[model samples]
Target: MSDIQDRHDSGGSGAGCGCLAVALLLAVVAVLLGRPFLTDDGDGGAQAAPEESVVATPTSERPRSKKPSGRRPGVVNIFTEQGLRGVRAAGTGIVVDPSGLVLTNNHVIQGATEIEGTDTDDRRTYPAQVLGYQKSGDIALIRLSGASGLKTAKFAEKWEVRLGDVVTAVGNAGGKGGTPSVVTGKVTALDRQITATDQSDGSSERLTGLIETNAPIKPGDSGGPLLNTSGQVIGMNTAASAGFDLEKKGASRGFAIPSAKALEIVRQIQRGEASDTVHIGRTALLGVQVRQPTTPSGGRAGGAYIADLIPGTPAEQAGLRARTTIVALDDEPVDSPGSLTDMLLRHHPGDTVRITWTNAAGERRTTPVTLGDGPPQ
Candidate 1:
């Protein structure tokens, strides 16, 4: 069950459409595990294309209910821009507080320079700002600007969920902006675990204690609600089985973070508690994409290779360039890209640190580089 494949859907059209296609593939999956449900618009600019359509097929064990009369009161459709790179992504979020506090999967808002949330009830779009996030747990909290008295989702008690319980997975499936998609099924398992690998950066993290269902969760459902029979939120939809085509298949298995666990993380974020796993605010950037070096024998060669440096970033301002190898950060040795990322995560924007690197000509150089604010990692 450990084998997982992440699939990227690029069916939509636009200027940066290809990026959205690639963004969908960024979901981490293990063997047979589906990618996290975040949809992309392809263009990173103001003009965005609508996400392709997604159809959900309910189980035959019970008759499907008629479509609800109106949109879910607390749920919102989420859209994000990743700087000027022209990559737009869409997902779902749950309103947790009346003052516009929203909860969602960290991946939904990861790397976003701008975020917008359209309430299902009001049909009004509001700008949003990330309050905090726990990247390891894949949970994030955001606040909508000028929002008040918003309806909040009801949470089911932790003891209320049981296997074989009927549940509905609701989300902005396929990144469609209007009414959220809903599919019903029974919970089949609990306490599930999986490793989600980000295809874009080869980074992966382990997710544990997930609720498993056959509710046909689809693209753009990430961070949406998995509601119990009484319309109480029991879990947050996170991932699904790869290639579970709803049009061709009756139902597909999906995974969700239990509401209890998600709520715990949210409480920590609300308390402004920053830990090894929780990031309190905006991400800091050295502004370089790096990779681990390999020797001729295919073994890792110590040091992170600077594949490219983003122009106008701290790395570029420090005179670091592509093809150089970063040896250390703040005097600590950097063995690989992951290690460098870990080191960076410990510091915040406006923090200055010593950087050590070697050029292609085997020339060693060291300097002080002040980090810059960047999109979420």
Candidate 2:
């Protein structure tokens, strides 16, 4: 598992400042559709560069481990290659059905041009097709092509999870393949909210009602299962805390979406529900591309500067144009493009919002615009 950066209700600006494409637009769509990842521009930091994929080859054909009764045989390793950048991301998944329907974090598979997975039984990789995703829930479901008769992870029937209860996290730590990493810890808290960022693009997401634990949720651990002492999955490991300052004590914290919540969202996604918070397509549109401001020293310029507005879109209809600087959404301060994207996460399609911006005339203006939905990216 790689280091994950996080903050409590207060969010960070995220590190490794640079211009990635507007991939966050999809996140905004997720928000508008009803579930928001509360992302923001925290204090500026150096953005981490994209990591190259490392596929390890076996030297010897080691015998597979004997299956332990009650252990989850359906836990899978999810691997994805996103965009032309080929920014690879890996995480854990749980097989939900014998037909190879798998569930994991949306952030784990978002923007993936190609997705694949390795089942625990055979450890053989298979091509995966995304069924659909719910951004607000931060969960996604995929179907392994030609996969069947796979074992599935079992979920706890009730909210048997309690503070101080022992738990185990299983996932691909450090994005490394092979057997999954199992880390043990106790539940520290529950129903907590935190903001998580994509190291690949500096995009942030606000997650709520998460199960907090001291378990080492690392990179590639996202979408893995948080198992109880009985080996039944109680939660889905999602975000890990990193970049803690002196004020904070100990190592980074890890958070997971409650299995009940995650499972509910997955079922909704599987049903292809088209409700306010659940949508079947790509993302909602504001029809505007934003760029970050640059400091005189050639560093990052905070806040999103409108670069282009898709003509005939809601933004144009609301009188927004290129060269406008978005400073706030619904009165929330906007310090980076991610901030605006984060704010958009709180809204849904067909919803009207008060967007504040600075025009080329140096005047601040506010407008209420209705959001529109678009096809998947």
Candidate 3:
């Protein structure tokens, strides 16, 4: 008994918090899937929002609905595999429309060369294609054919969330790996800020203005929904580091990037721009860490300035000097931190760009930088 007790004592508790990840949270409420509960700034955001408009191929172009239902099945699954012969890594997705617009966590479908979904009716899993994905925000959308009777998940306005409210989180928790599961919890925070970790390498992704709940989440829950009492989804539960304990789970924990931001990404995919969309692997995927710069004109109140650039990142490769004041990316001018982060993540690595900036010496410079592929380690 003493020896067993000694080992238990030595085992101890770990509070490393995954040694600090810059990643954002992904909630995967397995089994059936539930929904929960569910911001930002300038130039980057400005460019990102306007250019995005989700376009779903009209169902009229596809075969007729076999079993017409009042509510379309709103959720589907994204499948991935270690190799062609490896065990498939599949996660849940929410159907956004009858035309088969689907929303899921970026991580859930990260390496998937293809994705597919099935409804309650034993409909065969149909082929899925990435419509568009924004890793910084932990969101992605896919397109499917031959899907009908799809139930669209209802969304709550961002302002509708309140603290202490009960919520249900649903997704495929254990995976083909296991069956889907659902967990219940309450809103511990509204507009919480927390960093998520990359499942691939355990790097950190800073996600801000997110929802928090004292709920248990696991690997298969990556792309699930956080549903309110009314069964309306206010936020897409993206992630939480597995290392956190019961105590740390609440205070300053878990994150759900809001639906408003998701609306932008979903719209962009619907517009036929989905095929070439980039998945930069979340966090400040921009490769540039920045702060809001004070301006002479008080322009935009919180204009953004590049603070640090990752080596070999698009920003660094672009010849963008650290601490430079970025006035624009492509044709859109950046005025806020969130905007800049979103804008940079919107473009994939190796993509070309026209960047205009003001150097510390007050010299106006235009440098062309090609976006790099993959995230900074």
The top-ranked prediction according to TM-score is 1
Candidates 2 and 3 compared: the better one by TM-score is 2
Q: For residues 1-377, could you state the per-residue lDDT of candidate 1 as single tens digits?
A: 00102211223322212111233211100010112322211212222111110011223334433343223568988887765344566788999999999999887777677888988877778999998887778889999999998999887653345567788888877666677778887876666666666544345677766777778777678789988766878788886423232232455767788887788888998998988888887777787766666776988787877777667788889888788888898789988666676677777889998889998788989989888887664
lDDT (10s digit) by residue, model 2, range 221-273: 77888887767788888754233221226744677787777777778877777
Q: Regarding TM-score, does 1 or 3 come out ahead?
A: 1
Model 1: which ten-residue window has the lowest total lDDT?
A: 25-34
Sorting all predicted structures by TM-score, with the top scorer first, yields: 1, 2, 3
Provide the TM-score for each candidate, comma-separated.
Answer: 0.80, 0.62, 0.52
How many clashing residue pairs appear in each of the predictions shown? 11, 21, 58
Residue 337 C-alpha lDDT in model 3? 53
**lDDT per residue as tens, model 3, 253-328:** 3445566667767887567453323432321223454555665775444435666665655567657777777777
lDDT (Cα, 0-100) at 300 in candidate 1: 74
lDDT top scorer = 1
TM-score for candidate 3, residues paired by index: 0.52
**Range of the 10 consecutive residues with the lowest summed lDDT in candidate 2:** 48-57
State in Å the error of residue 84, model 2: 3.9
